[model samples]
Target: MVFKKFTNGCVNLVNKYLPDAFLFAIVLTIIVFLAGMGITQQTPMAMVKHWGTGFWSLLSFSMQMVLVLVLGTAMAKAPVFERLLTAIAMSAKTPGRAVVITAVVATVACWLNWGFGLIIGVLIAKEMAKRVKGVDYRLLIATGYAGMIVWHGGISGSIPLQIASGSAESLAQQTAGALTAQVPTSETIFAPFNLIICLLFLIFLPLVAHAMMPTKENTVTVDPRIFEEPPAPPAHKFTPAENFERNRVMWIITLALGYIYIVYNLVTTNFNLGLNIVNMIFLFVGLTLHGNLRRYIDALMASASTAGGIILQFPFYAGIMGMMTGVSAATGTSLAQVISNAFVSIATPVTFPLFTYLSAGIVNLFVPSGGGQWAVQGPIMMPAGVALGVKPAVTAMGIAWGDAWTNMIQPFWALPALGIAGLSARDIMGYCVIVLIMGGIITSAVFLLFGGMGWF
Candidate 1:
């Protein structure tokens, strides 16, 4: 009875505050502990090693975050860019339509860079909300962020994964060689398809939400103050040199890229240094680029503050991966058998992609990071696809589709979106839920059709 009471109290407290963090900690701890106990195939020490791996992984995560903040801030302050984004968000009048536009814009930005995508989408949604009255701003914000989920599936997303996979230099060379192989590039074709699908989504989503809007015609009161806030002043207010120096975040990303360039060239040239040593050098450079000793102290604190949730969850995720990998290694075809059995049971070939899409969507709930999810799921799915006679790229695309569509409703990405828009999930839930459901259905259908026809 005492134990039950303690558990209930803990649950209630967690439900009220830090729900995501609490859930991550609990799930990860249970998984890691079980793996450690040898209840799963993995030994505890393997899990420990995985946790140690996070020390390096977290640095990459930090680099991505810093890049996101700098790009976001740049987009937010750029007048021409801001106007273009706002126009995109406001293109569709209905809340659902607005969300589709937001998602497309976000996805495109994410394709270029995930961090920039989040910043631009959130900023645009916020601006649109300020201009329009009675619209659900939260939904728009969620829609904008949804685009970020698929970034890892795009061409640019391949780079970091290649690096982590220990194939970065080779992949970079291969990509460069393939650059001139196509007229417009594969990404160009995919971009238009994505845009068209988003347009279709915007058109249909409003009809779905029409039932939810207030029925009676009421006086539309437009706030004059909405129009009164002048546009952001010129960039001259902050000089170019000051902009570069003040935003240490940008410099970190630049340095990281430089490090990547050096590593790529060195590896291709058959240089001797290990990948670990290269990463260490980059970490040192990241630390040194901050300049002032005091600033480094503050940055350490700031980084910890921002990464608290991520750090807390790392052990558990690592544990889960350890257990899963162990199972795969021991059972030989066990994982493949399970997936193949699932695939065989599906009625049609189209159903296979649909299943892949839905499976990816479910995974996104727990693993929100696109690159991370790919790291975890990619290997499993690749062999599973071979066993099931599905193309690996098609399965990969399905994973991407699933990752992108669910970002609409997931609170992980929504926090930044909400922060920028001054809205809550509750405020946006009504509209975002509709977009999510619709987009998920549409995206799944697209994947299924493409996979079945071998169009991907």
Candidate 2:
């Protein structure tokens, strides 16, 4: 009873103060520590390996934090681009149209990077909300939160691509070729198709939702003044000539592209310059470009400050992943047998993806990290998929679709969006429930169709 009370108290405290990532970390740590204690008595070597894996996983996450911060800061400071985005968002005619536009914008933002997508999606939704009247806060929240779903399908998602290509290393090997083939293909095909589908759903969804709840009215209005004030031209701190002389943006872009090129080359060529050496190069370039030595010190400190939460949380996630992986490995065959048995009971081919989707959704509630879930589920599903004569990629897509669709209602990723928009998850769940249902159907159908065509 006392332990239960203590746990509950901790949960309430975390819910009040920390972000979901941090909260997840805290809970994960407690669970891992207890589990480790139990397992160490029987398998010390396995326990050691798990801890080691957790440590490396934490380091990888820290590196990801550094990358996210750099990209986020640069994007935020690019006033010209930000204003352009705002103008485009404000151009939508109705509140419903604005919501649809927000979804498309969110999808595009996620294509760049998940962190950028989440941040910018919130900003766009907030901008739209301010201009729109009688707007359902739920609708705004839905639009903002839906951005997370698109992240897995986006160009930079890495999760699905990693699974599709076998692993991160393999994906990196054919980076240039894959970039040439996949990027353009994604742009020409999936991107426009996704946009049109989202728009169509947006148009039809409210009508269906209205039918279900007949008493509720579609009550969203737009203010003319919101669109009347054209944004002032960006203040160029440097004149055109001065800007040309400074060349800060150009330098940054060049450095970024150079880093990507080097990384791609090293991976593709199977060269071993060492990841640490590459990181050092990035650190040196970032420090030098941000400013002189003194300013570099300031930048590092600022970056470190923002990275603290992520740094702490990542290890806990690693530990949880370690535990999950350990469990799966120990009972993998038995689990696979059970899943296979269940599969036999299902009636149709559609049942396979549907089952995987539902399982993914359930697991996502507990393990919101896409990479972590993939690590746990990939091995289990891949073998089953092979045995069943289903392409592994199709199974992977099923996982991704399920993971993405439920993110609409999951508070894990919603916290940041909520903070930025100044709304609770509850405020959003009302409308998002509709989107979730529609998205689920659409995603399942897409997977099934692609699976049949071997496109997945």
Candidate 3:
């Protein structure tokens, strides 16, 4: 079909032109640094210093992201995980169905918990790649990530949940109360308008991806050898040390400890499903299913390659984040301030939600974290929303989706899925660009429709 040809053409073009993830990060770093120099009065040396100070700023976050890829890949290697994934993959009778199923399952899982959704999406899509003959490896991964595109609309959506739980102290402090105190989940995450937008993406993204499957002759399937499982660690003549390494009791004990911790947190604190907790869950799940220390270590080694791009490049992005969003020790003007102020100047009261969404999308390129981005943009956009007579909750959701929308192209979020799938951003970003365009249309239409209804 013409559609398939166009999509395939796009893919080939990307494969020809797109660079590796590390280079992509470097290029983004250069661009942001230049922008910082142009937009702010900071000296080049000062900007470089800021970049240096900020390079390690994302260490904790980098570790969290690394774990998601590392542990998630290790978890997928377990015999139990692989079997479960294979069983589900087996249900898909054709290549297109595999892509569709992965997308739907990923979207729904992401709706419940973003981390769970993330790991599950990549794991399942990898399974499908291993099991489904002739599935385009890149398209399968793209479909999995497409499911993640809906995470901002899900229960774990950071900005909406923050506003819903009335814990937006950071925003309030920054904005001096330009944002209201609390706008319940009813007006944000669970809003009927938001739900309609979420539903459309959840249903349509997979179908669109399915439709984009390349012609039979042009389909690009990866070699099965790439996903082959590693051999279980060999046992020599019986010894106490070997027995200790091979025993399941230690694994079970460790698993029990993790479960106890999870229970204690859920009961005494709250359902703390942040990246750390989720990473812990992935760790324990990997350990338990892997069955023993030696086997787990082997599985870990097998998937360790997946984390290289993420590990090498996160610091550069952190540096870029520093220059663009961090206040200069001298000049004081941030690139984020300039870009956001420009948008703020042009936005009308009634049209601000759409601007909020678009502006968030722009800032999201430099600042990828949902909470971090909200902190930077919320103060400015939220106050403006109120002045323009926009609903606080709607303003909040608009920013949320904007953050999610740009994620499709940002290599930051794609690291985990790529690590799992053994693909680079260049392999799938072309397809993701298509998804991003579609997502923008859907998000823009929803924002406009509600804006017209005076639902601001």
Better of 1 and 2 by TM-score: 2
Which candidate should be chosen as best, given TM-score against the real structure? Answer: 3
Ranking by TM-score: 3, 2, 1
lDDT of 2 by residue, 1-456 (tens): 453344234334543654445664566555554555453332556655665575556567556545554444333324454476568766866666666667767756665456667767766776676655555444655665666666666544545455334444553333311221222324322444344444544455444332322112534333535424246468667677655645656556656676777777668844333334334444545544554333344444543444444455556556555544443345333222233235434624445666666666655654567776665555555455555665444555556656677776566566555544545555555455556766777766655665466543
Better of 1 and 3 by lDDT: 3
User: How many backbone clashes can be found in candidate 2?
Assistant: 0
Each model's lDDT: 0.50, 0.53, 0.83
Q: How many clashes in candidate 3?
A: 1
- Count of backbone clashes for each model? 0, 0, 1
Candidate 2 TM-score over all chains jointly:
0.59
Q: What residue pairs clash in candidate 2, if any at all?
A: none
TM-score of every model?
0.58, 0.59, 0.94
- TM-score quality measure for candidate 3: 0.94
